[model samples]
Target: MKKQTLLVAVLAALSVQAGAAVPEKTADTVLKPQPGQTQAAVWASRVLTKLHYKSTPLDDAMSEKIFDRYFKSLDSEKMFFTQADIDQYAVVRTRLDDAITGENLSVPFAIFNLYQQRFNERIAYARELLKTKFDFSTDESYQYDREKVEWAKTDAEVKDLWRKRVKNEWLRLKLAGKDDKAIRETLDKRYDSYLSPSRKLTNEDVFQIFMNAYAMSIEPHTNYLGPRAAEAFDIAMRLSLEGIGCILQSRDDYTVVREVIVGSPAALSGKIKVGDKIVGVAKDDKTPMTEVLGWRLDDVVALIRGPKDSTVRLEIVPADAGPDGKHATIALVRQKISMEEQSAKKTILEVKDGNVKRRIGVISLPTFYQDFEARRKGDKDFKSATRDVARLLAELKKDKVDNVLVDLRNNGGGSLSEAVELTGLFIDKGPVVQQRNGENKVEIESDTNAGMAWDGPLGVLINRGSASASEIFAAAIQDYGRGIIIGEPSFGKGTVQTLFGLDRFSQNDKVHYGELKFTIAQFFRINGGTTQLRGVTPDIKLPTMADSDSYGESSYDNALPWTQIKPAVYIPAGEVKEIVPLLDKRHEARVSKDKDFQYLAEDIALVKKQRKENSISLNETVRRKERDTQEARSKLREARLLATPGADDPILVPDPKDALNKAIAAKPASGKTAPVPKVAGVKGALRSDDGLQGSERTLAAELEAEKAAKAAKDVLLNEAVHILADEVGLLKTDTRMALRVLPYAADTK
Candidate 1:
């Protein structure tokens, strides 16, 4: 909130609450900025109005929108606030436009204060309800997802919801085999932390949070970063951290592990998993574990991060946990994650077309990474996504692969320059993408590089997680008809953000205002369609982990709408549009008869069906049976796949020298390490003409690492290979039909 609102002592002067039943805050408040956040907010507002690509006006229309978004962010599920509370907040809701320019944020701060008071009431009542046991015998259902539900009318209404919530949590703990005493202790520690909400917060924190609600109300990608958040942002750009090596975010009251970096302590530990909810954290073996249920994501991060070799025990609720399942605690050592292991990797898959076997190369890019410092120092070998992928493409060409698949699953995007340059490797020189600024000015980013690396049949594999630069490259390839897109729709993060450090705007350097990361540009494909929310649709769809309806850009309410301008003039190279139908037909037929694909379809069907359910059975018997049935089915499917030949496809392992393969080497059956075996002409764990790499790794460690990698591989990628093979089959059948031929394509021969 703006600094001019009030001082810490002002709480004593106010006896009346603004619009809610909240009384004067008896607890202490974080110090507001002495100068009020007016300077920062006004500055940000002015910049955004002039620079943000959306160029949306900040009138009372946006003001009310911001008000709604602020509360939605604080209480996303509509559980904490009532219609009366919202009614009370109506005044401030109309004053944001003036307040932002005038440097007045009293209303926003007031709303936040009321939110805190309501949260306290809800949590305290929940603690009391936890004191008694719940009657699971009664057929009661709780709607866990209340995002679209109506606000409760009275305290009684909310109290009933909290009771069910508390009961459900207790039942899960009891199912996990914890005693009543243990469950109560856990609940106690969790609830007690809730009484104090802003204890660790600074004025900057409040200002950032309030302003971010405003900014994000304009669009999903625009945000405000406090000083601490800005520092962390820079650290992430460096792609290294001294911590448990897992990315974390606050989801509801739980701290969720978002991504586990390979070669880091979390990934190497073999215990941590993505989507795991961390409830409590302990330092070393002796220190008492502290509950972090109500802690801010940054605070949880601070607790998890420490000096190398320090032990951090994490009490985790597995991602797959049901309402009546147990959680476990695991200990891991803190270490530095350098992100070297997250670089682009290469492997080869052998696909059979008719009676002949063809080798198809695959490149997996985790992110669009670049070593800016190294490049600035004139290091020719500086690591970068474009450079690395280019080198890998050359290697694939040397091995004479028939087709190439670019695996961009879960690649959330980076480095726009890399995205443009990467597209150059596939298509002839032309406009790659168009960028429109806040002023409605358009600039075309083109690939002037005349050289092409891979002009053969190509496919890109994407899912809801592929975004930003991933969308740019994929869109450009699709626009140019350079490749066929396979898999789910990409994440619709077409907006471009630029970080501005607030210190530059300040006259005083002693105290730093935070930073603003606002959207400066939006990406448009060569076909002139903006990728804003309607991300690049794939040529063919594959069964995904989650449907786009449940995830991706379309899920956000404030995302920019997709639109189109005049298409950039460029001749299409390939008949991908015509070929896609044939490939789709073959794919449908293959997956229908394939056992692995059948199991995949069945699993996906189950998940989608489960997603429609608002409530699950509270009875322990029913829940246990559900879990057991799922497990039994999974085991049976696994056994069947393992027994079938070609059902177990091995991933191409990246060379150890390039990427950090620090995962615990797979143990050999005899407890002995063997040199990489010569198989299928695969050398050093890379592809050659002979066969696929199997024994190229020290057998003991190679096997284990391959096993781990295989378990994580989805059936979609193997399907992508089959689709690519079909394209190759088309090309072989009609050799006279030239498809997107590179000017220098003969050089590969």
Candidate 2:
């Protein structure tokens, strides 16, 4: 009682809103518990409170956090509820700890029920608003980023916000030349999609979301996946299947294309990109694309994905397109390939570094993936990143490429074992990364493989999206003085998480509990510093949006801190640090005058400027003028670049059939690409007695990889080549890292 009183006083000092208990009434009914949900939630809580790296105490303080998170999750934008709603739910806010442990599953379900009710009302309001005409001439603006604002005091206040929100969207569509009738239909469909999904949110779904709110409060990556989501995880891990091969995420009530997976139908079609919105889908070329703006993600995915050789047409709103802006129709042929995602691709780029035209080999590795099934089956020719990259390096040697750029941008890590093995390709066997488990025990992971793959003029290209095994690989290269690290700091995802199946702990076969991902270990770089939050900083920094703290591991409030322990026992392979200054100097001079690089800088600055905007003018004429001015400037820039043939790709409506051909045509003259050599598809390059037969040559695979690199138009990669070229000409091969080393905190045998 004394400890609880003291904790309440401490929370009061902190002035946390959720910690305060105000006078309130408990609702009559909360959600009914699923058969095994109570036990699963309790088990998940115990594991989190015990094993998580933060080890946050399970007390009133944590209860307050969980309450606040649940409320925020239910109504983040405050569009669905008013202050009265928050006050009414106050009784259950402080009772979550009891609910989780004692099987009183009422509070979470009750809150979700209220949220669903409010959301339904909002959807109805939106539909009505769409029916009415918006006078865009009114001099008004919508404050879009509502995250910093407080909840509306009344339903009337929220309705006004939603009205302006609907009006702003309508105004944009009007500016894009959409008529009232078409705009109404578009909005109707969008609202319908949003409302339609609410019906699908079963008690299990709501429970999962509420539970995740608690799990996420502990740490960002740690979470509880319900059965449905767990099955999706199973599919994603399989890596490849027949579909459009487009990665998607739900943003702003639309399915946004996160990535057009390389070598897939989406990439070959060339209509999809990072921020493009899939507003509609069609079954075939003859059918009109169905609008999918507010549609559930899985439903939208089901509509697009089909069997191999089948076609799905997509209606896409390009990233830069405004509301009602021109939409492109793309049709893609689905192709099924088994675990081709793990394959390493190589491309040689021809660039002028001073008077010399250097053939810079760019080896693009998407992830550290291995065919676990094949390896388990004792297949010697099992496709693995280490083997593929090693073979690609050998091909690079054959081509006599002047320098190498290992592009690791946007690569969410996969296999940790593969990271060590890949590092082994560069430096002769040594310690790679240290794993620190839950008990503070340390284990050294090393690359014991013999023979260096390629040691000359290596550069690793990374971005803020790079993480986990990517960090391990980059840190090893930097620490060993093996290569020059370039681009923004990587995503600091060094903590290790293992999924715990909840079914194992359930009382009986009444219901199948899901899985809990709990952080159990931390990864330390070979140099002793953990890449938990402060990721591997580059030796040569590049212009990037990730330079800001808005992205990557640093953005999470509970992310682990950067700490240095002790360096592993290993000799420096070679010193590339000695040449960084020279590389940096050359890089600076080049980017300052380089047209492509200047465009990247200008684009980044413009994005940053736009991110600072607090509101947008809702006045129709003013908004149209602003849009026109921006569009005009973009068009003029595109025209100038097109005239000179710069690699900066202007938005174009491409014929799906020509995209692959055009990509192939973009390859440099000395570059090569082909089917993954006879070696790639076969077990071992060949039998000891067999001779090379068939049309499968290594040249085409190298050439295809080259073509893909050209299609991507990577600025950082080009600069890496220039930097490497400078090193080759100016620095001695015997150079070594001159940075002083820090010792390990304790010995790990």
Candidate 3:
């Protein structure tokens, strides 16, 4: 028999023995490597070893890292497997490298099978504990985050851990006003839901997880996407999908709506919302609802997707609702939903600076996006961030905005081409970024187009979530002295990835393979320093909730180190460095007396205190006291803000889709200019100036007050606008300063 066939036979024999030892429900199905997986494993290993930017050898050291990563991926909380299980699996710890290269997947498959068995056992134990009455009066605690803890030495110890976990769950529900019977039923269903998803896992799913462990061990960004995930990746890049128009994420066997795309059917219905748990799905009114509480997220997505105009019904539990709360069913028509929410949006902020009201055009860019499929098919008007912002800049000019601020806060970046094109719109054509490959060959990527968009004055706002293309654009604008880089340091991801289709490596047409997104190059700013580990530091730094060590690239153990190459030759647009000190000083003076800033500092302190705690008390009284204290503080802040002047006035920022539609509607048939709509004082906008939806108010008064506290005014953006206004005033008074800082402004138009 062939090696692959022999391996399959051995796996089947092992499955039979394991089945005889476990319950029939848990061991009825065993996952084994599919035929195509062996080929895929070999292909992925070859491509990664040869073509990866790091070019790290797949030696013993790498094998051990892969082993630990795989185990962590399987049981990050260290709740399933025992130390004995790890000892037994140690034999293959240093052999995974060879297995991956030689097409031997038996070891990985065997380990996964044991993990599944252990998981089912834990779930069963948890369900059994639900039958016992849990005492909320006990002064015990539960260490929920166990990533750094040692594994239990025996099965009994693991069971003890699960006992505390179950007790904590019971206490949480009881605190949420659930009765004893309801708590038991909710927990019983939750544990069973956990087992259902594990039981449905396929061989392909296990293979994908193991492969990603190997890939991430080599580098942080390198990843393996299975066939289904590959298609999803394409859809994300195109920014369009035929579905109910919401992003879904899997959280503990529950499919949660992460975001409701604006202008999509779900958002129009105003029924679906972020943090809503999708428990069931139905094709139409006639079809019976299929319970999908424990279904895989991709499987649930498949059920939600259909032809345009088709109706899909979903049962959801609201975010504010407890697990035992009521569920509501909503029917929505599927459509080709363009992710217009991610597009660039503009709003004019009127800032009063020493009796001079300066109109600051603030553009919030969520990502650098492009519709690649449409662009490839020769569509001239294919959606892109650059094109949209260019149009917005022209409209801002017509509105007589004094300066422009591009808000890239929490923009995790998208297309590299769009970043370059967008940067081109700011400066008069120069090198934007540099690419360095494995061979150490450096190539410059420049914006060759010559022009300027809103060159009067500019600022780029960023935060820890800004990365890749966002960093590229910000770094370019900063390097050319074109704009003031504001806010927190970026996410520090400077590497570039190239997606490779795995099916191209094999000749067999029947089998569907996945894709590999591997790092191929590193990106450097025009000033020569790479943003690998040290993300772009803003010209005017703002206070952040967390330090760099708490998050960003520095948090990744295997992330690439910061480096520098030869700087690309480029002309500076103006001397922003000369005026940064004055801008920073003025900003500091204003925020020092600002009540909102003081509240922000207090919130940051509270977050830091919470982050330091690794465990929570299981006593219901102690937990409730802590919760009440938090609610009291939130109410105090809300009352203070409400007492401030203009607190009730809504800050009007137009929705991207609404703004685009109005701009189109305002155009005339005679080709004559019509009065452009005033971009201010529109009430009850869907999104705030900070790019987040207004919090949904709950029925509970305290909870509503807490949400209201969170929905306070955007102090950071307001400060940025003030800083820009100050710069405008400084330049207007000094002719020499104007000549030094406003060189590009004269060349505009």
Best by lDDT: 3
Better of 1 and 3 by lDDT: 3
lDDT of 2 by residue, 1-749 (tens): 01111111222222211111111212222345674778788888888888786787666667778888787766665677788988987776667888888877877887788877787788789889987877877888888766557989988998999899888767766776778887787777766656544543445656776787889888778888876566455444445566877777566567877655656766655456666888889977777767777655666766776788988888888876887899888778877644454457777766654566667788888887766666889989776778889988998888887667899998888778889999988887799999888678899999887768885667899999899889999999898888889988889888877778888887676567788877778889888888888788999999876534457888776777777778788887766666788779988997898776777788788777766876888887897787877666555444443343343221222334446855674342334432221212222111121111111223233334344334544456667766766665664332232221111101110
Clashes (N, CA, C under 3 Å) per candidate: 9, 20, 0
Residue-wise lDDT of candidate 1 within 171-219, one digit each (tens)? Answer: 7667656788987877776666545433434445456667888888888
Error of 3 at 595 (Å): 2.2
* Candidates sorted on lDDT, descending: 3, 1, 2
Winner on lDDT between 1 and 2 is 1
TM-score of each: 0.76, 0.74, 0.81
- Quote the lDDT for 677 in model 1: 25
Best by TM-score: 3
In terms of lDDT, model 2 sits at 0.69
| Each model's lDDT | 0.71, 0.69, 0.78
Clashes of 3: 0
Question: What stretches of model 1 exceed 4 Å from their correct place?
Answer: 1-36, 174-182, 189-199, 238-337, 353-356, 371-382, 544-550, 619-625, 637-710, 738-744, 747-749
Where is model 3 poorest over a 10-residue stretch in terms of lDDT? 1-10
Which portions of model 3 miss their true places by more than 4 Å?
1-27, 133-140, 174-182, 243-297, 303-335, 619-622, 639-712, 747-749
Model 1: pairs clashing at backbone N, Cα or C within 3 Å = 3-36, 3-37, 4-36, 176-326, 666-700, 666-701, 666-704, 680-690, 680-691
Model 2 residue 212 CA deviation in Å: 1.4
